[model samples]
Target: MSNPKIFVARLLGLDVFDPLGDRLGRLRDVVVVDRGLHQPPIATGLVIEVPGKKRVFVPMTRVTSMDSGQILTTGLINLRRFSRRGAEQTVAGDLFDRRMVLVDEEGRLEHEHESVLEDLAIERQRNGDWIVTEVYVREVTGRGAFGRARGQHRLVDWDRSRWARGTEPQGATSFVAAHEDLKPADLADMLHDMTDKRRVEVANELQDERLADVLQELPDDDQVQILSHLDIERAADVLEEMDPDDAADLLGELPDNQQELLLELMEPEDAEDVRRLLEYEEDTAGSVMTPVPVIMAPEATVAEAMATIRQTEISPARASLVIVARPPLETPTGRYLGVVHFQKLLRYPPPEPLGNLLDKDLEPVSDLAPVTHVTRELATYNLTCIPVVNEQQRVVGAVTVDDVLDHILPEDWRAMDPDQTPAPSTENPAPTAGGPASARGGAPAAPAAGPTTNRRT
Candidate 1:
């Protein structure tokens, strides 16, 4: 039989019908299983979103014919909720519009080129089953001024790009490889133009830490939309991966019911930190500071401090400095001794205690410090993060410049396409606390303004 191609995008939300031509529901997602690398993943079934019922699964084995955006099936639509099993990948849910590299007829990757999937071409097999045959792609050239006009776009069968499924490298072989090398911020930027449904689909495919990083870079609306789509369990996991302040801010956007549910699902300690941040009124340092940080005790050696940072998976911004405190060390949190900027520690030998290297002059901010004051302090000191202390001068959390920008920028600033990389630390989860604080350079600034506290040394 001659191959008749159907784009997966055209099939999504199209009417699905029974053999008798009676309407059943709309095609919500296409399910497939990975057959290993460089092979086309097999179409196992279709998920139909019936109006009054949960999405139902119809096995492709029983699919009779597909034509003109309609799916005619001989199978009984299983009334039970459609559940994705292990090794199964969905087309609309997983691979639609994902970025992939196009290879030539000889299987060599194109030079300095990439394409966003426009659609998938499905063809019928001899066994009367359907499988993906070709990929429809649109090559995007350079953007025009004001980011308005991008160059000429044409759709083509870029290559015989077959789908290869695996958890570590899921979807097409090219995308699997390319996406692995992309930082979370880059990935977030790529998803900016995608529809919320498509964005959520991609979100579901990302690991918790990666999703958390991407969420931080997305607009608040998109953040809430994507998180709302995630199951409470997964949402909680992503929240745990996020900085406590960001997570708290996001949770504030959700309905109280959902917010509370996700909080309850989170680890008790992490949840409490978020809850505490939530208690602070918006625009306060306490409201924007991350309650969890790479904190060290006064007596910890440079070696021990670096060891603690290395052992913990913190993002670069969080790792920029290791806050040293008295007892009750927790972030957004304990007796504020002082801070040891990562750069200051690198200047000292390993056995030198952090207490000796502490930047004692870096006065801590009150929890209620005004946003303007927080901004000025950071800008004045060329700092990315500063400690937020309670009335007792105990360290509670640290306010990051990024969080400060999130609040002070215009409400719609989130809509801005990141022309540059999102922040100093693009690594997921949290950046490792190893590099010099100045390694991720910021704009040179004026002298520090706050009162220099007395140094014990």
Candidate 2:
């Protein structure tokens, strides 16, 4: 049967399965090799985000089926993480919405006009190799505010489109739009896989709040790299958007001078909070604890506490427990009354005073306590979070289970694959049915049909 042409956009997010019907991951991007100025790029592989949020490359040769909603491949799969190389680019990440000149069949630029590359269409040849054969583009009609442009859209053969050369600043509007729904952690994983240039471009394009959330999920090096690339003022703004403890942690990675400059640029209140956290030694309850936990006064009602935790900005760990203090409910709050677990709030009447239901017997940890002490206290009491009190008996902050785990885990835990079993090296000999390809490179073959339902091997 003749192979059908597929638009690359439709393939994104499709579930990928092995020959035995076991799901391996979802398709995230198409890897293509550049084939000179006027030739169609060859589709080499698919970037699949597998279990544990790790992305791996699957050579096109191993793909057996490409049905709606899912893709099927030969059982042989490499468990190694995907890393892009020179001469290769991702269709969605690198090309989509890129500016290119419209050319005629003779390869001459048409009327000095430019168009935005919106999408690419890839077709499988009779011999099974897949190539990007067509491009959908939108002519740049005019420019508007914020670099936005008005355009008329059309489709053209790939050979008639010439990618504009030179270091024109590429906007990440389309790229961010493609993955806008991704969680911060998943988006961080995708960013971790991108080339440094592309990663910085996308980071700069993201809103401060969104970027802050993603920064917290990234490894320390990545966080520093991205922040260092930004303008000092903007970097400070992003830091202000992050949780006080996270901002302090990231700032701690920089030189003292740079840290002071960024802090100086931040709003006074935000800077103060981060400065307080920075005063503590690393891995201590004071350093890792979030100073913005849901705190209310003793006179606050159960309903008020519930409403406070219900805010979208409050994290689950912070919301799990409400600290009831005296006047000045903020961190460094007035006399630490006690904490009321979320469960207790649910049990009591809406108007019940938080002071009457406080868990007084549950002691707060000292800010100077080591992480080991905090971890043990949390584990012993089966608590999601515990308040950290200063020498004055004021609620200074709260350390949650996540904070403890983050401190206790290996420093490189974010980059480590969750499945610790060693995977067969990609340099190994090919197997009879399906086999691993050379690291960073592979060839294509014809496609075949396979089963769809997921099952264990």
Each model's C-alpha lDDT?
Answer: 0.69, 0.79
TM per candidate comes to: 0.56, 0.58
lDDT string, candidate 2, 97-153, tens digits: 688887777878886668877677888888778888877777888887977656777
Q: Indicate which candidate wins on TM-score.
A: 2
Clashes of 1: 11
- lDDT score, candidate 1, position 102: 61
lDDT, candidate 2, equals 0.79
Q: List the residue pairs that clash in candidate 2.
A: 128-446
Best by lDDT: 2
